[model samples]
Target chain A: MNLGLDRNTIYPATHMWRRFSYFFFAIFFCFAIAANLLAQDWIKSGTGLGVERIRIAVPEFKAANQDPRNSELLRTFNDTLWNDLTNAGIFEMVSKSFYPLGQIGAPSDVKFDTWGQTPVNAAMLVFGNLGASGNNVVVQGWLEDVKNPNSPPVLAKQYTDNATTQQARVIAHKFADEIIFRLGGGINGIAETQIYYVSTRSGHKEIWAMDYDGANQHPVTTLGTISLSPHVSPDGSRLAFSSFNGSAWEIRMFSFDLNRMVSFPRYGRTNLSPSWAPDGTRLAFSSSRSGTPEIYAVDQSGGNLHRLTNSGTTNVSPTWNRKTGSEIAWVSRHGDLPKIFTMSADGTNVQQLTDQGYAVSPSWSPNGQFLVFSWMRHYGPGAPGSQDIYLMDVTNKQWVQLTHDGGRNDFPCWSPDNRHIVFQSNRSGSLQIWSMLADGSNQKQLTTSGTNSEPDWSWK
Target chain B: MKQSQSRWIALVFALGAILFLGACHKKAAPAPPPPPPPPPTPTATLTANPETIDKGQSTTLTWQTSNATDISIEGVGAVQPNGTQQVTPTESTTYTLTAKGAGGTQTATARVTVNAPPPPPPPPPPSLTEEQLFAQNVKDVYFDYDKSDVRADQQSLVQADAAFLQQHPNMSVTIEGHCDERGSTEYNLALGDNRASAVKNALVAAGVPADRVKTVSFGKEKPFCTESNEACWQQNRRGHFVLNK
Candidate 1:
């Protein structure tokens, strides 16, 4: 029997290397399946469907050398990783006081009984070590099931970058994402994502960007004019916003590829609130080119203009359901006050989604399952309620308030994972960008110095 | 008797000479030359630099005076005795400079030619385009809170605006809808649009062409007043007119 084998010409080293790689791949595949199964069961429990939130203990990373940069970089890395996991909404972190009083850095140093037993009582254990050698920083991290210590670690990773504080935070985010993927029901984490928002820190409302956790806040536009409603493109290469170009408010685009403003055709009227389709080939905005502020759509290159709403009343703020890219949600004032409405992308099958009060800034979830918008349920001169962000199920029309009495919260955008939301609120005396889990827990203020509003989270 | 006659002649001759001398003294004394004619009547001459210019351009008006205490130009208020000023007049204008002194006032004039564009030009030196005149004369009609209809008190203003548009038959205008900063950005935009539309409709009903009246909404983004008060808000919520040239 010929099995396409050349046994006589096979080299011993090559044969051994091929066999070793095959075994390695087989083990890797098996471990991946095992880890996925474990995470699936844990997610069910974490969601209150089975048991409870996973108890994870993260000990401070050990320092490998006495370099002066090691302590600072290690602190940044540890803090970032801890905050990422804490904000994940699924973990019950064990406090540092409960940690065993000894160094827990390498896999060989892990004591299963110490972490798995009572008093420490962690279901999962995260440990790592960081060091800086000359200009480079190196880190190694692992996630192990303390409950099943005999099994292999669910995650093991190493990262190397320039010995800088920012890179340290980045490496921490990457490691946290890996752990989240292995234990958060196979969904990718959003720790590394960026958010774009309008900030008044520069004396003008210009587009500003920051890391998901609100670090590295920087301005993206220096237009020195009043710019609002910043919506980043789905591909994360362009930012579309409404800018007052001295005479009129027009839709403007800033290209990240060129690091400057790009040319877009002015629609000859008040054009505002540009939203991108999921495919990044089209945009929907509100324009008064047709004598009324109606919802309009245009191509990415500013061609193929089409009108979507003919309601002679006030129709504006068109947002696309990014998952399907077939439906859009907007605000209309056919009656006394504005209400939210949704319609097909081709301008047919219009449906009213909101029945009462003032609803505006409807941002659809990435899954196409819910719309998160700012609403004043009892709106009037002396109404009892304030404007707050609310999330609603598209299929059932049921809703839940995500912000309560926290001043006025508006312009909520969903993260790519659909587990987090970034919004603007005036709870801290000024409008600032904030982030929270989908259930409204872990609300963290992302911007504090400037009046920031209209956050848009990046797609990736 | 000859001596007596010669003496008599000499006496006559002396008397005539004395009379002649008196006349010469009265004429040749010069009467102080009439006190130099009172500071030369305070003369002043005004001249324009680059006397002819296109409309919207500026020119220097220079003046010179011999002796004056108070100097002023018409429509320009007070000025120095002899100085130059850069003036930008929307239309062709003749500037008159007056100099007042103890001696009676004196006046001089300079013409600044604001030339109109050529080819079928309107036949007036102090002419402004229909659009420019409309911007200066048209009135903005106001609205109530969350209401788009032209208010009863604002009807006269709307009529006035319509009357201006009617007089300028060749002009086109854009009415901007604005709102106070008391509502959401999107809703205010719609509200502003309604306000603009209501004013446009009122103008059209008053006999202005609908095609010549365009509308746009600035929402609450551009406020006529920035203070947080009722008076400011009332000023903000109106149909502002812009010339479409």
Candidate 2:
């Protein structure tokens, strides 16, 4: 090493050139490392700014056929698809009003440069065409990554169904679901689900079903007496609810396939708040059959009965942990007020989830990480709090109040995808069903004509 | 394109609304200051003819007042203040008269007493029919919202109902449990069931036959008071007794 350094020390010109080359190499290496690091997105968890929804674009599909009915299908499909994408909560949908005057709504017609401009600025695009054929409707859809020119589309799908308004809407929902599945990190979309609730529009309470977007409101039971707390099965074949049969309350199972009351067992005392397990094999409900209110489980056929809780102090509203299927979250009155509690399905390891106040209507999230419940922090004759909805992180017992003191909000149920909550509130003067995102944003009224309550979001 | 069209239409409609309102405002006279509130007037009156009477006989009561939007008696409900009404007292008792209006409220009392007892051989039966008497004997047992257990304060009512059931061995009573319009409807139904069962259990504990009592839960469907206030809700949540025919 000394001998090599002696030659460089004697040659000033060579030494200067070596120094310059070393400096240049060092600067280039730094830039290459920094550029690679800068290309990645920074992930954070400590602030509300962590949420970054993917931006997407959807344009009204072109009418593929000349039939007049084809116009109706196209319009319906477009509106429904827009609503589904907007409500997904994982997408930032671009406004159609921002689209360029030249509408290119097909795979062959797309000009990527126009969409990549300032007004559109879409990362993903959903384009499709719909037509009416005899008694069926046909749709062709393509979802493209506008930035990727090598292989343009990320998803391509086709759906065909009977040529009815309901079927047309369903096709749009399915296509949106497919796009969500492909780009939303495998989270299922809630577009094709239904919401069942109680409506008093007919002068008496009855079970009513509606689309997830509050479309297609129709009564499922015309029992003429009071019916409440409707829970649809996992497969969407039957609905279980409690109806006043001019006597006491009974669990009545109504078949959607038959559109009539199917035979279920008539238990003694009263049965209420029917909740379905993640699997459709059994149901968990509250019953006074044991001379006091307790949580009970029964098969879907109303056989093989077993009691889950014997708290003897109004144990009620038993909702299962849909993910584990081993634990149940319910309301139990162990102290001065009713509180939310979680217990093993066999009533073995009962643990109180709430420490104080009047809490009821505990609904486990689909992900099994949190629970949504109605709580009155200082509940009493002259308490200082109003009933509202709250979300609790089960692991840490950290709770976030969803609704303020607007009105008495209760009976909150989670949507299938765990992105939304449907509840009842008296905020609009009378009891009405309302919906909101899981974070308590985007509140919307679902029922206007009649008093609605006890909303149960459907399983997929 | 459709969204833009709607937005343009909305903008036009908003402008039209503003201009129409401006025109109306221009043509209209300045609104006069609100008229002074009407002077409040006090109301007070009371009279009873033949206050003393035999047991089981009724007395005529009349009163007049200057200003009253509503009037009521202690037992009898809403009545005209200047009108005469009849009241039947089973024994010596006092009747409270109240008159209410925007001004305020005034109350008065009158006494009615039985002059003498029957001639020792036979007692005077009440003027009320047996069915009506039984209806009065049946009292509603109250409960807390979503509670099926009998409260400490409401135990006396359940005991009295049990005694009434025992007095008429051949009678069957239906215990209807009701709830306030709060909480989930299905949960309330179960709570109502528990409430009725609790009342029935109380009666059975008090030596009343279990077979003579039947239970039903109306949940929140049948409410005694439709008002959405705390007092009304308290009245709505109860274990009511009805005699089955």
Candidate 3:
């Protein structure tokens, strides 16, 4: 048989070797190229899952006053808003060079195409008139969504009564929430909320109320007596607190609008930790009038006194879970650690929800699925001084640590949406109101004055 | 030549046969001894007594195990016999003993009773001292923040403190002013000082001599009760007298 160089014929050994080498080389080259493409595809698909990269353009804030240079208040407000939005994890803010519009409230109209050419998906225009109003500085501005310039921008107004140039940063935080609510799909604006806390600037414990961002702080009671446990009504209209009237601890009510005060029945004993019921018609408080510290419910008119707890183990801090209209949360000393216990408003079906350390001061979320409380672990002496805030899921019985580094953080109050909690801490070297996301991120200090504590966020 | 070629082919075939057999035998042979019996099976033994212990008291248990084994126990009286073992008892403690070497375990515990302790001796019958029985009852007196000057509203509380001081001329007392846990340590300290001074001044004005009373401000350092509410704060923000005979 003769083998020749025909169309599909095998040739001599030398030619066969050359052909085999070329075929092998082609196959190897294809495999290498395919592997590279496969790797690129996997990376793209992996990163494409809900991971969005967005750039933001924050214009320099223009002050309402015709000051030649930028005011420190304006600068602080601008910086705070920038930090809040960046920490919200929704935007990657672009540099100032990208936004040549100069300042936020600058007179020049925003050029949409200018922001569009850059990678910025949204441009925040925060231009406000900051001027003194009575004892406060009012900031009024509108946030425009440059992505869709034709759409109407949202209006945001913040008032910082008793504000110094430094406190303007807190007002800016309120404004930032407004912006987040409008654009970032969070909750309702927190600007109108109030915080009730105990202040001793007057040399005695006085119940004080301030805006959620620590503005417009004012004393609720002027009796010059000892006042503590200032609990805001569910609607944020009235404050139910305990005050010593030179005799015994009495539960008192202070109307925020009328500024009038009324004391509950002079029950020759100490009444403390008044928590307003969801219906706002009754208050649940711990009282020793029953011979021992027990939980009792009093009407808004201080009538119909009903005792809910008879366990006699110093059940204090009774907070009603508005979400579960029938459940009440409190701290029970019946256990070794003051653990969190939940019971029916009628005082049945008691369930212990936590077993981790000494937990106290339980504040339930509006949704009734979780409780935020202070967990303490005393290290050296006296009373186990180390304390931090922890969040527990009532349904799953899971706890997540909210503050780790804040020194002795306690008194955690949840925002209406349960997304953010306002707590008190000496982390910044002084007792101050600080806020963080529910999952323990974006922690920012809200107050800087002498010593502020026991901050209770308003439901409104 | 054809015959010689055939011979050479046979020889080559034989050599190939031998080599293939050798390769097959190598592949099928048993592996070398499996690394020296894998260090011996470390023994760990755990043992305890009474397996159950009562609450509030310490229970000791001994354990012996190989390979430096650690022991642990569980249940109401659950405790670590030593620092190495754990003890937890309130009511009905269960303990588990665990050790190494075949994963051995032996548990013994004593019953733990979480009953309340015996009551203390009763106090003497209530008796009023002659001074307390005859002391004038002053009702009220008030003062400003960090100021000892008597205010108009607190006439009743101050009157009582002063009346008590006046009636007991021979008895000395210490007045302590306290502030709530709300402000700076220094501020509260100063405020407490002012409160005590103000109360003393009021007592002196109400006809009581200043020598009978001493004043000190705890500031916010010491709170009668630690709570964030207004009631606890009210309790902390007051002046108390420690009367001495």
Supply the TM-score for candidate 2: 0.73
- The global C-alpha lDDT for each of the candidates, from Candidate 1 onward, is 0.80, 0.77, 0.61
C-alpha RMSD values across all candidates: 18.8, 29.3, 41.0
Docking class of 1: acceptable
The TM-scores, one per candidate, come to 0.73, 0.73, 0.54
TM-score, A chain, model 2: 0.86
- Best candidate per TM-score, number? 1
Q: lDDT tens string, model 1, A1-460?
A: 2211234423244533343233222222212223321223223212211134568899999998888888899899999999998876657789999999987779899988999877988988999899999889999999988877777788889999999999999999999988777777666788889999989898988999999999999999999988888888988999999988866778999999999999999987678889999999999998877776789999999999999999877787888997899999998885677888999998999988878788888999887767999988887777854788887766556666677745878888999877788988888888898898775656889899978888999998
| Residue A123 in model 2: lDDT | 74
TM-score of each model's B chain?
0.49, 0.47, 0.41
Off by over 4 Å in 3: A1-55, A61-98, A101-108, A117-142, A149-178, A377-385, A428-430, B1-245
lDDT of 1 by residue, B1-245 (tens): 54355445645654564466457656855768556655546899999998898877899999997677778887687898888899997667777777766554677878777776566865664336565576678888888877888889999999998998898787788889999977776668667877888899999999999999888778887799999778999999999998776
Best-to-worst ranking by DockQ: 1, 2, 3
In the predicted model 1, the residue pairs found to clash are none
Candidate 1, superposed: residue stretches over 4 Å from native: A1-50, B1-137, B168-174, B209-216, B227-231, B242-245
Question: Per-residue CA lDDT of candidate 2, range B117-169, in tens?
Answer: 67787445543354576788978899876566799998888888888879888
Q: Pick the candidate with the highest lDDT.
A: 1
Clashes of 1: 0
